[model samples]
Target: MKLLRVGPAGHERPALLDADGVARDIGGLLGGAEGAGGARDIDGSLLADPDALARIAAADPAGLPALDAGLRIGPPLARIGKIVCIGLNYHDHAIETGAQPPAEPVVFMKAPDTVVGPYDTVLVPRGSTKTDWEVELAVVIGRELRYAASRQEAMAAVAGYAVAHDVSEREFQTERGGQWDKGKNCETFNPLGPWLVTADEVPDPQALSLKLWVNGRLRQDGTTGDQIFPVAEVVRYLSHFMTLYPGDVINTGTPAGVALGQPEPRPYLRAGDVVELTIDGLGRQRQELKPA
Candidate 1:
């Protein structure tokens, strides 16, 4: 099942794409008619429910409006509580950045405000040099958990996954007096969605292919197969410290081929550069870069 939120940013409604590739108005199934019963507010639960998915699969989308032709898609996970990220999780990405594989995962945080729709515009921050792109697989948590007992247990808590672009401004990221947050938290930095594919649909998250293109030129091209700490392990590892709650998103790092990893060092995004990225079976996203 590919779950989505469509329409204007704040007013987007819950929607589902069935197995037959038809769009259904799950907004009603979510809560009730008029989006009542507070079911619409429980999208996370619906995604985790087999019966709910069945209902969506069996739905007759004939009468529904044509999937909101003008709708601007938003991040698949609504009401996100946190945006955690892993750094140097891909072996090739590590080597590209001139760093050794870490003994353990390196974690960081991106401000929730950085969240934007898959096709939204990416702002090249003011005075920014080294703005870069990272195509990552984002894990969406369905249940609240702390101190997860094992990787299998952690895997069970996953709601689904989506394609995420972790756009960074390197100067602010490194030259600033603080941590990577200074560079990673810029507005419109994280563009997620196109769809939130449920975990059941993805039997092996580690085997997926991921790629990114900037202005039609390939930038990042790699696979989740290279992840140092795979999805389940990442969730389990983070749970040992901070609690993973429903709707909290974790970007599982990116593969090699980022602009920063280039030998000559491209410093930033310019107006009109387009970034298109994808993760196998998850979905794809395209965003245009613009000066802030």
Candidate 2:
């Protein structure tokens, strides 16, 4: 099932992209009828429900009202709790950034507010150059987990996957005397989702090809197959240290060819640059860079 949210930014509504590629409202499924449950945002509870996606898949698109012709697409889900990241999880990425692949996953955090619609304008940090792009596969959690016992168990906790642009500001990251979060948490840094392709539909996350381009010129092109840690292991590993909850997102990491890994004098995003990316089954997301 491909689940999404549509409409203006903060006023978005739950929707499903039917097989015919039409957006169908899911408000009724979320209890939008009179006397129905609270008209809550498409939040965490929906992600945790096993039957929710099945129902969405079965929803009749013909009976629902199609979205207004030009409404903006919003992030696929609402109330995403955390934007977790794994650094250097891809073997080629680690090598390109001049580091050895760690025996374990290296983790970081991006403030949830940093997330924006896939086609939204991305803001270049004030007084800074070195804004960069990373094409990654984002794993969304469906179940509560304290410590997943194995890779298979960890995979079971996954709800779906989406295409993600893990935008970054390198100067704030490596230059500042702080964690990588500094560069990662800037507004509009993480542009996610055209749809959250359900886990059941994505059979093998590691087999997908993800690529990104800046201003129509290709920059990053690699596959999850090169990931050093892989999705299931990373989730399982992180579960030992923290509780993984519904609506939480884990950016499984990027493959090589980021601006930071380019030789000296590599150009970064400038105002008016369009960055577009795609992951095989997950769909594509584009962003136009703008001055902060």
- Candidate 1 lDDT at 25 equals 64
Candidate 2 root-mean-square deviation in Å: 2.1
Global CA lDDT computed for model 2 = 0.87
lDDT of 1 at 171: 82
Worst 10 residues of 2 by lDDT: 31-40
List runs of model 2 lying over 4 Å from the truth: 32-38
Q: Spell out the clash pairs found in candidate 1.
A: 30-39, 30-40, 31-39, 31-40, 130-267
Q: Model 1 reaches what TM-score against the true structure?
A: 0.92
Give the whole-model CA lDDT for all candidates, comma-separated. 0.83, 0.87
Give each model's clash number.
5, 0
Q: Candidate 2's residue-wise lDDT over 1-292, tens digit each? A: 8888898888888887877888888877754223113465455688776566566667788888787747888899788889889998888889989998898788999988998999899999898789999999999998898888999999999999999899999999989987898889999999989898889999998899988988888898999999998899989999998999988999999999899999989788888899999999888998888899
